[model samples]
Target chain A: MAYVKINKDRCKGCGLCIQNCKLALLVIVEDELNVLGYHPVGFVDGEGECKGCKFCAETCPDCAIEVYK
Target chain B: MTTEAKDKPKKVYGRPESLKDVGFHFCPGCNHGNVHKMVAEAIDEFGVREKTIGVAGVGCGVFLYNYIDIDVLEAPHGRACAEATGVSRVHPDHVVFTYQGDGDLAAIGIAETIHAANRGEHITVLFVNNTVYGMTGGQMAPTTLLGQKTTTSPYGREFMGEGYPIKMAEMLATLEGTAFVARVACNTPKNIMAAKRAIKKAFKMQIDKMGFTFVEILSACPTNWGMDAVTANKRVEEEMIPYFPLGILKERTTADYL
Candidate 1:
């Protein structure tokens, strides 16, 4: 199984990961903001398990995503 | 720490060791941040952090010294390649590279860039061509595509008046001094991985004393381009790539050229 972790404080909320994810499993949390006052990204509720592709981590300019498999 | 947390798999991606643990001032979705990470990763992979000197040109990339944890020199507008030349000659043992944008390199600094490549200065150049002057607003840059609109070119870029987009990689690849020349984009995961490989190869050329090396990255300036981040990235892939085709334009073998 693959697990993805987002560093909320480090995320700049660019949404590149959400847009680039091949699985379409990530989304931006619009209800809350990070320390930088931007919407943070997270996996969608009840989404399938992460494929461990690391595309989200690779696309994140802020280095906010970490993937473990 | 909880037992479950301790049993997690190994972390696969994180901030590179050569980067400073600080926030970037670049706008959200700016590819400069991504390029910075790639360069930092190259430095860390080569273990040359202590012996690397980065030259920052005027433009949005001027803050490169802030994000990258290396000895960086602030050069005048369009003079990063010239400044890098001086640094490389003075300290040939150290790895020298310059970070520049289209306005700073393709337009005002074209002379310096061409001359440095011709001279084989043994330095690496990271060129970000976002089709406009990002820092000083969306001015029409030399790399701006034909018919592209900018703050200066309000209507659209006219080839008769503004000339066509300057393909820096193709132009530099023609020089005998350059050991490596590639153009890559950062809008997609596949392209980003290719860009990282090109960046690493450019640095390796410098370390091997193979002479000048250049990598032009087609980045997106959403703030200036008047598009959302996702749409801007899409433009890079759908529109820009067709005009600026990506790949290694030149890669001279050490034995044949050097």
Candidate 2:
């Protein structure tokens, strides 16, 4: 099984991960603001298993995503 | 998979040891952060973090010292190559590199850059080409594409006045001094991986004492490009890649004379 962690403060909310994730498991949490005042990426739980491909983590400019398998 | 194995996840990807724990000061969706991460990863992989010295050029990447936890020297605008030449000569055994932006490498420092490479300075150079002077509110750079609008090129970059976008990788590859020369981009996951590989190879070449090495990374400038992160990345694929062309332009296993 694979999962990912996002550091909210580190996230600049560029949405690169959201766009690049093959499983489409990440989304920008629009309702709340992170410490940096940008919409942080949130993992949609149980929707799909993260393949551990690390596409999202690699695509993240802010190094906010940490993938675990 | 076993339940215990599933429960306790092994970290597959995270921050590189060579990078500082602090968050980046770059704007949202800027490519500098990604490129910085790659460089740190390369340094960590080589186990040269302690001996590696970075010379930073003026531009967005001027704060390279803050992100990468390595000894760094700040060079004057477009003088990074010259500074790196001196540092590499002084510390012959240490791993030395210069991180420069397009404006610093292809514009103001063009003469210095060429001369250093021509002299076969034993150093590595990381050229971040975003095609615009990002830090100064998006002024036209030597690598700025034709028909691309910037603060200075309001109407667009015309061939008559601006000539053409400079191709640093191909240009530098022509010199006999360069051991390795490549152009890579961070627009997509695959490209990002390739960029990292190229950067690592460039470092390896320098470690092998081949000659001057260069890697030109095509990065996106979302804020300066007046586009969202995703769109700017798309522009890198659509516009930049076509003109710049990716892959290793030159690689030498042994010195030219040998």
Candidate 3:
């Protein structure tokens, strides 16, 4: 039972988490709060497969991603 | 009761008796005893005693195998990093850590130390930097202050000949592979507690499958320094602290832990 949470406030718009997620959980959404002019973070929309490995969280520079199982 | 006299009762607070008790070989009032106790306690706290493997160095702590209850390995003079790498890599599930001194680490084994951090080996390192070599009388180490006299330098060390003290934490913290790097002193009760936390966190980082973790523990060798315990402790505050301030030099949150 792996649950994932991302602290959006810590996101520096570096997009490293999205690049490292390995899972198709995160998506880039562009809107008013996408201050970096990019989709900062979007969670797994329908929860297909997460693996719960937490590679993205471990590699995040700004501590933007969190995962607990 | 004499106002100026008090006897400390012998206490059995470290490891359990089932592991076959063996006493340490440290000098009287040596800080190694307290460090051993704290390391033992850290193992117990993490419940890894049964699965913990301790690597001993070639300094005064060479006989550390006798004191700790867990499985122990004796590394060659300044080869603890090499030895620990094997143990930790082979047994990834177990908690592996190495205990080394200033002479062993900052002197001869510097290559292995840097490579180990660069490789980001998943192991804990308990670094004891006492400035002077403890096992072979008082000789200058890579960390010996500029003017501190030792057997090797009867006169205060000359900067032209000896070079400056190496701030290892700062050097290692700059590496991109190291996950956790902190320096802590083990002189007072408060500092001891902080040291324990630093050590435990290093272990926990490994358990969490994080990368390399190093805790440079500032210790004292009163016998080798030709000073009493009180004076040795005082020197750690006055001389050592200035060079190696106590704090988390570089630490990452769970999100940043790798």
Candidate 2 residue-wise lDDT, B124-242, digit = tens: 99999999998989999999999999999999999999899999999999999999999999999899999999999999989989999999999999999999999999999999999
Candidate 3 off by > 4 Å: A1-69, B1-20, B254-258
Candidates, ranked, lDDT: 2, 1, 3
Best-performing candidate as measured by lDDT:
2
Whole-model lDDT, model 2? 0.93
Local accuracy of candidate 3 as per-residue lDDT tens digits, B139-204: 999999889889998897778999999988888889866788999886665677788789889988
Proportion of true inter-chain contacts also present in candidate 2: 0.93
Tens-place lDDT per residue, model 2, A1-69, is 788999998998999998998778999898979888998889986954778899988988888889988
Error of 1 at B177 (Å): 0.9
TM-score of chain B of each: 0.96, 0.97, 0.90
Place model 1 in a CAPRI quality band: medium
Worst 10 residues of 3 chain B by lDDT: B9-18
Q: Fraction of true inter-chain Cα contacts (below 8 Å) kept per model?
A: 0.74, 0.93, 0.00
lDDT of 1 by residue, B125-202 (tens): 999999999999889999999999998998899988988898889999998888999999999999999999999999
